[model samples]
Target: MDLGLKGKNAIVTGATRGIGRAIADLLADEGVNVSVCARKADEVAATVSALEAKGVKAFGQVVDIADAAALQGFVRASAEALGGLDILVSNASALVQGARPEDWKAMFEIDILGAVNALDAARPHLEAAAGKTGDAAVVLISSISAAEAAAPSAYGAMKAAQIHFAKGVAREGAPKGLRCNVVSPGTVFFEGGVWGNVKAAMPAFFEQMLKRNPTGRMATPEEIAAATVFLCSPRSAFTTGINMVVDGGISQRANF
Candidate 1:
């Protein structure tokens, strides 16, 4: 029941809303000292306040992960604020648009480059924690799109690259007591946003999405967050360099 998370410090990127926010709240609830970040200063402060209400130490920063230097500064600040870092959840970026040549830049910048920035900056702190308890872990928030073609172009390709890079990081960092793994969520519904955007921008595509999934439903952010926390916990001590997919059987059916 303890989850052994009390006093453990964590950094959750993109923590102002949606899945990142949910993950931050859950970690704080379990007694983890958490530092959350977003590009907006007000949103970061507000999110930290919300987490503080849960009675755990929390910090927030305005970090544009697309900028490596800024993200490094944010990580260092988070470590300084929390006294140390034991867990890192790299949950940054908007799910990029598909592989039109124009979408390439933004997709790679956020999805690929941003991940490199966070993981690199947090390695030292995470390594120190691993040295202390042999349990420090980095959880890369990927998507089920990595395994399927549903998400299309830039998003899907970059995600697949994330998985490969995560594995390489796991192998390199494992010797230093660091662990890295990827968590992929399928069709996560982020209410009042994408679903609605899809309805207005492209209705037929949305309908096809609903029909492709065997469960006739999309996953909630909380459901994905639970799996994410498990990966970060001692519960998954031996799990690394893997992609744990959470899709309502969406990726399994080849012929829908």
Candidate 2:
């Protein structure tokens, strides 16, 4: 299970909690230097400290993903601090599952454009690292909602856009030895996450969703992270331009 991740460096956005945090933690566990960002300053500091405790170089910044300047700044600073970037995980989401204009705007700015800006900033560093290692990856955290049509929401549209965008990035970056892929997780559950709040406020609905999964439960953040970090590893060097669904079979669509 050696992933060839030791000594590599990565940036994971919205990494102070939940799936993003899990991805950063797992990467650090595999000896990858990690730079992470979230909006809260104290949480960022604590996460950075926790990751550093795992014996990998770790950096954190308080960043509002909706702000392109701040998002790009973090990416550039992370690349400088980490010496280079081999992996970039666009894990932030606005979580706006509504049809309003404001909802669409937020999703576009934070979820879609946030990733766009980060990739732009990291492109040079990723290209350089790819030249040396022949393995650089970008894993976008999408959702199964991207393919499923439970309702018309800006969230699903933006998530679908991310998958499409990653496909293009994969094709264009391949010549430079960079791989881009999407990890579409379905109903991942964690404390203070979407499902956790649903369980508290709308028990019946939450139970319905829980029952919908043949596994009798939703995915854990760690499960999604494991898939994501693996795709970002040299172990999956040939994996690109693909949407790897990690939903415990909750998603019925055959990947092929």
Candidate 3:
């Protein structure tokens, strides 16, 4: 299916690895010029090189998403570098699950403010793109934990906050042909990721978690990316203010 993404430009945060990298790769595959940012300079460079090899214009910068000024600067630079921005994917997170004060602070700074800052920086560019093409999109990479609470978790609370933010953005941007949505993944597994670490250090607990999924496995980064990139595409022009869960049936909550 043609995603209608060719010639568009996008910026993705935390694009060096995991789901962020997967989203960037898929956007590039669909002929979108992409600008990516991550904390590691080497990873950012390598990711840019890889994206360029796909025959699309690609740019990357080392950025700390927790720094609002730096992140907003990167977004503006990306729009200028790529000529305009039609898509924005906020995929960076602190991934802090503890109930400590420091953990909450980190999650709020990176997970919540990160998405807010990116959108604030990209709003004008996105609105302009929508004016020309009749569509522009923002996809926030949240988690199914947003709706599930087995304990007090800053991670889950911040994730839930992201959903609320997306909905508001969608409503506000609707008149301008700009859409915002959230992609909430359940237990996504990739090398060096949370689940991967668990699998290596706590095999029994990892196995227990794995068995909870009806699919008998956790989702791959690519799986989550597919859903994300699609939502960012013009193909899903009408899909906005919605949380699309891609959890491989591990999340029991009904989306409706």
Could you say which candidate leads in lDDT?
Answer: 3
Residue-level lDDT tens digits of model 2 in 1-256: 8999999999999999999999999999999999999999999999999999999999989999988898899999998998999999999999999989999999999889999999999999999999998989999999999999878899999999999999999999999999999999999888899999999999999999988999999999999999999999999999999998888788788778
Q: Can you list the residue pairs that collide in candidate 3?
A: none
TM-score of each: 0.92, 0.98, 0.99
**Poorest 10 consecutive residues by lDDT, candidate 2:** 247-256
Q: Per-residue CA lDDT of candidate 1, range 1-256, in tens? A: 6577788999999888888988998899888999998988999999999989999889988887888899899899999999999999988865776688767777788878888888788888998998998889898888877867854578888888889989998888877778889888888777655665776788898888888889887777889888888888876788888888888788874522
Q: What overall lDDT goes with each candidate model?
A: 0.85, 0.94, 0.96
Question: Could you give me the TM-score of model 1 versus the true structure?
Answer: 0.92
lDDT: the better of candidates 1 and 3: 3
TM-score winner between 2 and 3, please give it. Answer: 3
* Candidate 3 off by > 4 Å: none
Which lDDT value does model 2 have at 217? 96
Best by TM-score: 3
Off by over 4 Å in 2: none
